[model samples]
Target: MKDTDTAEETSPEPKGVNLFGVDPLIIQDHYEIDYRHSYAQDSPFFVGLSKGDLLGSRCTGCQYMYATPRSHCMECGATTTWEKLPLIGRVHTFTVCYYGGESFLKETPFILVLVEFQNVNTLFLSRLKSIAPEEVHIGLPIRPRFTKAPTFRVTDVWFEPMGST
Candidate 1:
């Protein structure tokens, strides 16, 4: 067999949606949006946001917590136990985004981070706040910021640099 590492997979970029439903400027965008809606709504992630707590799932048999709330353990395929996790970790990786396609976050420069919960042996990718670009670094500590929405609808999950409070 040929080595895949030596080869590159190339494809055309998908265009945005077309004006008519029948016509697809970019089919991938439609699938991407559908994928997000299917997973993001009514899941444990949303429920956790509503409660002002970070929720994760753990393999009951293995004691491994899933930061993104999966149904089964990736390691053992066992049913997971739901639990709350302390909103603390260190940034294992991060990137600054200057633009958000959505209206709510448009033009807001924000930090996208992957934090490693050392105790759980898991990582969470989330948005970070209250820190300048120069201050962000690998292994920087951070904590969650629970926010409430109008009419009791929980909406946002935000985190800030540690010691910012």
Candidate 2:
């Protein structure tokens, strides 16, 4: 057999646009990413969201309860088991988004909160409902407001304050 170095030396030219070529790569290209995003919403967490129940994953090794459950644990790489979580939580932190991308621009001046479920190790981000953006505060008691007709999507999850004292 011919030596690899010698073989490569006699090989045909590679079939790609070289960087130093006269016709350089196109600097402006817009790709429309239009396809069904099917994987992220296929988990037990999304199923529970559709059913108006809070579901999570518990790590068997470290006992970490993820509000938005993944199939595996982030810490120990162990398989996780599905667990039910309470809908009620408190606002750990928050922001009032006045503008964002096209989809979010329609919902301007909305309160987005990072919620900490009672006794859970992690916090979850969701939109705060039934509360004005100016009224949101840290440690505000909140509960998830699920759609009545049940849309099987993550955006179906939002929170409402429980009237803090």
What are the models' TM-scores?
0.68, 0.73
Candidates' C-alpha lDDT: 0.74, 0.80
Candidate 2 backbone overlaps, count: 0
lDDT, candidate 2, 51-136, per-residue tens? 88888788988998887767788999998888888878999999888887776788887878888998788889888878877788
Q: Residue 73 in model 2: shift from native, Å?
A: 1.4
Clashing pairs in 2: none
For candidate 1, the per-residue lDDT at 37 reads 33
Give the top-scoring candidate (lDDT): 2
- Highest TM-score against the true fold, candidate: 2
Q: Model 2 compared with the native: what TM-score?
A: 0.73
Steric clash pairs (candidate 1): none
Question: How do the residues 1-165 of candidate 1 rate in per-residue lDDT, one tens digit apiece?
Answer: 356643334433345644445565444553334332344433666766777877778898788887767788899888887788877788899989888757437647878888788567578888888999889999898988877662223337767888997
